[model samples]
Target: MRKWLVSVLLLCALPGLSGVCHGAGFKVSEQGAKAMGMGNAFAAQADDASALYFNPAGIAFLPGIQVSLGALGILVPQTDFHGTTPLSGTPPLDTGTAVVTEHSRRDIVIAPTLYASYALENLPLSFGLGVNATYPLSKSWDDSSVFRNQVQIASIKPINFQPTVAYRVDALNLGVAAGIDITYAMVSLQKSLYSPVIDPTAPAPPFGAYEVGSLGLNGTAIYMGYNLGLLWKPRRDLSFGLAYRSKITLDITGDANFLATTPTGMGAIGLSDSALFPYTRAHASSSASTSITLPDTLDLAIAWRPTDRITLEFDATRTGWSSFEKLEFHFDSPQFAAFNNQPDPRKWRDVWSYKFGAQYVVNPRLALRAGYSFDESPVPDQTVDPLLPDADRHSFSVGTGIGTTLGSVDLAYMWVHFVDRAVHNQEMTTLRGSNGVFKSDAYLLAANLNLKF
Candidate 1:
């Protein structure tokens, strides 16, 4: 029963609810900014408790017991949206018209993580375990003023669990780990507009309420995936690492609610005479279900220690976002092709990230770290929307750690600046019910804590 509950929560908590970043891309990079600030290139450089998130093998080297925790803040810019209805036939009496609108918020979110491990004194091998959230940030928007033609989306959060093991041989070491991921997600979409055609046969004044739809939709499901990582210490001062996270398939099933006004109901509600325009004369609800694919990822990293007081590291990673090209759903009857026959053209060409960082040892009990990285956006320009407002980004980060006889404490801050991106896809927006060209910008902050015994 707990597993079933977990499964349901996983679907409802994951997916990012079309929260932007090109589909569900934002959910892909939710690690604390300290890791992100370091370019997420710590696989080989895993020495601290946080290493549990990237490579569980690193935990084997930990002596005694240790723990770590922290949080991060993130912001993404909004995209421009525009839509137009091509007029083709005869002209009819019209009472109202539809216009375009937009909205972008600089909202920030905080993410936290925890890690623990123990080393055996009598054995040549070491074993460890940990639980932490990798994907940990999200955003939302619902402004009627700017998104008149666009679908309003709200609430997206996805979390996960990781466990691992490691061993050492002379001067070299190796390790492996796996992940048990859980997620949950919910969404609300709405589109409203005015049209200037009123039928004399139609009940009252302005032709009734022709506008609302899908006030809310929620889905919950459970998925399974794994993680593997490798670490090698070529010399006392040099270490290298590699890791991979498998993809997850989400099967969402749930209920939906919709609102609409028609000739029969509008006249009775006294709204038939309120406006002059085109309107929908029906409101209803239905069952909703969908299947979506999350992507997989691979990372390679290196760490170097030229002196007792300094360490330098670098990392590179690839994400299989291209695997997520379309979302399909099953219904009780004929399926509503909400997205049209548009095969997800998101050829999301694979992307790569590069990071460089350095940690300074001020003393046996103190350390400071700093890093820089460049990331590429996977969303093609034509499909960018509120569902995923992704763009190429630049990230910077800094942090410090204090050691104690029982454990250690770590703190970090990261700043991500999203370049302004403009979206120009009339057909794409129409499929998703959006108004015009879209544009936006964003930022983020983060923190973490670690303990050892």
Candidate 2:
């Protein structure tokens, strides 16, 4: 019974572990509608209020006070999975014969952002503030699906507040900026626990595998980091930009709850014998803690304008996912002390993304934009799971800007297609689900209102 309890706790903690390590894949890059329309390649052409997030230094070139309010709506279709794993079936059923097809739940997620900047009239200095949701996720599977024990539901919501200052060297056509990033995150997960051993309550011998109970966890954390940006333009028609965001460590504290499905199964066994299974309580609760390191990111880009009506830009972004090397957890309750302070190695590697975007101004009140990007997956096959089935992806976007008397309204639409992934991980046991192929895709729509005062 103690062994089963340890297994349940470990499984319950995995959502928090994997969610932070692979957050780069789920990071909300579309903080501004203009940038999203340009495939997030606007670092060099950051001319509007949203520049506070893309390239803070650009604020130094602005004329007066500006504000931007925007929101991104994301819709992910159901992800398809097919294949079999070690724990796909009961004892009598062969793993190969238990092949099955499953689909993840369809969900929509919305992330909002706000940015305000002010440029002093007499000084070449600017101050700005930004609030946005940088990491947001909502994923789930059916209760009776093959992956029920692996992950039934997982949700992560994070908010970031940034205050920035930028100085411009007009003589050298250069601008430099720095900012602090204060982030708060909340996470929740739910999954079922499975017992590999035969059920003693069964009427016959060779009792089939069954579920012990369900486990739920809720956690919250707060962390701080910094970001820096540089923008240089040697000529009127060309510009270069560089941006860096530092890493942060989040120490999370939460509580776990267990609810048994039946009173006669393993729960009754432990209740019937207290001496041998003193720690095996059917409905148990405990306090838990864990820490994870979020990776840093670097962006480099260039923008060019061959004609007054047209502009083009290209950008490359690198994420230092290699920083996520290990994960550890602790339980404050004595019953779970046996499995505390164990470290697990995660060999995630660094990855890069390339983006290209173009903008054409047709008139004073109208503009059109289009962009494309290719992003690489950071999670290795060994660590991939239903909680985060990441893969290489391609994104395409288009948008329009409408100038109004008060300000401007920008609208963008993007489609992301993830490459199919096939996994044969060694981490699978009868407790976790089997290896399989996963295919996924998503659609995003964004709108922003920019006002100049």
Maximum-TM-score candidate = 2
All candidates' TM-scores? 0.77, 0.91
lDDT, each prediction: 0.54, 0.79
- lDDT tens readout by residue for model 1, 199-221: 22242343322332224556555
For residues 142-175, could you state the per-residue lDDT of candidate 2 as single tens digits? 9877777778888888888999999999999999
Q: In candidate 1, which residue ranges exceed 4 Å CA deviation?
A: 1-24, 28-37, 75-102, 124-130, 178-210, 262-283, 333-346, 428-441
Best by lDDT: 2
Clashing pairs in 2: 85-434
Residue-level lDDT for 327 in candidate 1: 45
Per-residue error for 374 in candidate 2, Å, reads 0.7
Give the TM-score comparing model 2 with the true structure, all chains together: 0.91
Stretches of candidate 2 off by over 4 Å are 1-13, 21-24, 90-97, 198-209, 262-281, 426-430
